[model samples]
Target: MSRVRNGLIGRGLIPVWLLLPIVALFAVGYVLPLSQLVLKSLQSEGSWSLKSYLEIAHSPTFFWIVLRTLTLAATVTLICLLVAYPLAYMIARCSPRVASLMLLVVTLPYLTSVLIRTYGWIVLLGPSGPINKTLLQLGVISEPLQMVFNAAGVYIGMVQVQLPLMVFPLYAALARVNPSLTKAAQSLGSPPTDAFLRVTLPASMPGLVSGCTLVFLSCLGFYITPELLGGPDDYLIAQGISLRVLILGNFSDAAAQSSLLLLAVIMIFLVFRRRIAEELDDSSRFDDISPLGATASGLAARRPIVERASLLSHHVGLRIHEALTSVRRPLLRFFAGLALLLLTLPFAVVIPLAFSDAPYLTFPPPGYSLRWFSRLFSNTQWLDALSFSLRWAGLSALLSVAVGVPAAFALVRHRFPGRLAIYLLLISPLIVPHVVMAVSLFFALAGTSLIGSPLAFALGYAIIGAPYAVVVTIAGLKRFDRTLERAATSLGANQITILRTVTLPLLLPTLASAAIFAFIVGFDDVVFGLFLSGPNATPLPMRMWDNIRLEISPQIAVVAVMFLAVLAILGLLRLFVGAAIEGRRSQAKT
Candidate 1:
């Protein structure tokens, strides 16, 4: 026990010493407001009662809201799965170069803020927008479609935003499949369709399940897209809970709604547990990769004319992969051309539009100028909000990493009691909608000094962000060999020195990944920002919310574009860095 303690002390296992500013900041911002939230919820009108919970249970509107939220979440998940599966499967089966390009195209949208990305859908789906204009020009419609502020708009935005979540897991799962298994089945006299059905599909089920779980989990907590795109009557549980707490100040009712929503989501996860577990298992029969006496080329050559035509109908996918990967520069150029049109155009439009002189949105503005950009800077409210956001993000990111690194190490290196439970608790923030958490927090911390402070807000946001850091960091740690640390120790290095020279260097990539994730979580946050932030602590997202609600300001668009650009740059950097590290590791193995 003494040696263990001494070893830990020597290794820098001691917790980080919180700076005076951070401690003061957290106390005022997080701890105080949270306490107030709980006190307010429980001691309403000077008496503690179950009346608030009972009132929420009795409300018909709450039940309907809950149902609508779940329905929207489930629908979005279904759509993401349907669209993402084929894309994921194609990418997985393609050559490495092609697969990488396809994955990049699919995930690029994920780099943008949800608000900005959802706004793109708003423009596309709005009445008299391009879609309507195009249809009219083609003589296919007599009038502009009423697409925005409807379920259709909601579906479009949600599916587009969540598609990557579905695609990523499915792609990972599909990539793990042994290519030869399908070929072997085909050689045993099964038809190609039957071979894939009986072999490839079942083998890739884990990725499909993981993707579905992730998408479904994320969809349940979606606030921005649905709130922006859907009609007021189309309130989901998140919107409902947000209204109850931030707008209506009905803390108890919001808590009850949140508790129920959490329960429902947990139940859904429980139902899908076995499938998800099977998917996560590394020892499963899915990872074998040696090919059976066939290749994709061989399969294509033997296909009958009818089968060929059917395959030809799907030939665009093959061509895309080929174009993306082929040694011929022309083929690669063809793929790049398509990406420019479909993926890059929307992003390009926003950057120039931020400099528009015209008041209204247009493709080629009436003589572009830096009017909005200047206006964005001159706005004191926005400037204050921007400063607040930066400070909160920087502080929250630091604190989250501080807590997250140790927890990740503990999770990766040691087995302890209730480990799984601790994991679930840590990641629960990921599954539970932020609005619901905000509500529970409002109830949980009522009457404390933490309510309405920046620290309280950051604390809540940090909790949400920490799980992502831990999960990513643990993935890095798992890939890391402990042998290097042991070797360093044997060569006369102490624990701290070994960690500094060995573990930290090895885990730096994951650490950066975690930091980026933490920043993104803080940056895109709205639900907690809405509930927790006060005038002094208002972040950029909250400020945007205020601007949108108060007036039709083009400066909001400028803010949105700048924010998106920063996030995109950061995301690209992270991606390249991660890829580089992965490449280095692979080379070392070879």
Candidate 2:
């Protein structure tokens, strides 16, 4: 039996078997749907043609919408970078305990549903909401300002929603930088600012780039925030696609637009693919191929003009450094605190509003009561939506785990041909925009009776969620010690017995984390729910989205609070599981 197993492993059959389930899931759930969408885009009246693409190309409206989407994504990425850099730096510089707390604060908004966050902004920025009401009361403004339904609201909501994406990556990069390098630069007679720019900043460029890429790509597909906050002119490409399909019933045009958006996403991924992979694997050595080194090498070819510009910038930097040296730390702390406050502001607003006695959304309610929570629980539609969301999320998590764990094993434990291709295929769902996936899935499922069924939602969500599972499980596998497996094998244990008795138990904590992540991905998703959900299968986020658009009510706040509560419970559960795992490990060592 052992000889047979070894022979199978040597022939790469084991890895192939392990990888098969996930490959099939991706094919049916992702590739087929997307292929259908592409084919639909190229079809006109049952004949293949370029009509839709040509129509889009010739339409000035399409041009502006695409341009607007790009501009919005770029602008949001820039703002998030500016706001998150200081906060991430501060967190990195703090003590571990304090840093963890601050990091949680930064991630608070991110953990909350985008719908809930957007609704929070609605309550806070509405004409009669808190900010305007306070301003009116203080005579800061005589009348309420138009804040919510405009570009200002879109920026605020998007920045708040996406800020943590930027912060986490930046923090990871900053935390990895050697403090001694900065000190060494200072010891060489460089100012603090110069040392940071010359040493720390260059080292953290990978994180900066990764964060920007994530934010930009995410902003491109943003539907909930912009739709809820922006005026008509603020319509983005994602909104355009949604309108074409949902309102106009124009699948071909929507498909064409989706194809273009997908193309842009693929191009971006290809451009930054190597950097993202290196960052994820922690394989990049900053000292060897630093951004500064790259710049210097590039500048070597155009020395004279670049040298003069560099000297001028250096002189200006020195002067600015001298002037701001004493207050620099204070400024960084202040800005970081401000950014964190912005991140937490929605939670602070929503929690109290959840208890509002009034039916409408207003801060500092005339009286406090549990009316909304009662209504939320009593409402049949809300209850049904919640039930469906929970069921679908569970199924999605289960499917993700079943498919992802073996793929992780194959990728991490075996070497084979097409391994890289398999890995890329598994993670490609993460690169594709959610709206595009939603559209593709919709097109593929439209002809089937399963269109709005729980199975449909589960399969769609699993496609996206499986990537998280694979990535997390791969990390766990990389950390796992194979010596224990070898010991078990030497004791005459077969592969199945070794896996059952040793591997699964050791990987329990990581598997649990992966499941929780997958569940959250399914639960918080609004795009898939939007396109695939029917009257009978509506998810909670979809329900909340409807309430947000049709009416602004305190019940939505109750749902938002529920989301936070669910997040907190999951987080505590994760910590508990991790501690238990650690305790067992310690006991075993003893």
Q: Kindly list the per-residue Cα lDDT of model 1 for residues 1-590, writing each as its tens digit.
A: 99998987654433222123333433543445444544444555668866766777788987787688778878888877766766777777779998888777776676566766665666667675677788999999999988889888888778878877887878877787776777786678655554565456655666777787878887887888888889988888788777877778776666555666666777877676555444223444445534442234224334434444535566664454344434534533454344324444445555666778987766445677888888878889888888887888777777777777777776566555555555555555667667766765655555677777787767777877777777777777766877767877878999779888767866777888788778778877887776677657788888777654555355666876777677668767867876876676566446
Q: Per-residue lDDT of 117-146 in model 2, one digit per residue for the tens?
A: 888898889888888988999999989999
Displacement of the residue 406 alpha carbon in candidate 2, Å: 1.8
Query: Superposing all C-alpha atoms, what RMSD in Å does each candidate have to the true structure?
Result: 7.3, 3.1
Model 2 TM:
0.93
Name the 10 consecutive residues with the lowest summed lDDT in model 2.
298-307
Best by TM-score: 2
Off by over 4 Å in 1: 1-59, 270-349, 443-449, 481-483, 550-553, 568-590
Total clashing pairs for each candidate: 25, 0
Model 1 vs. true fold: TM: 0.80
- Global lDDT of each candidate: 0.68, 0.85
Question: Which residue pairs in candidate 2 collide?
Answer: none
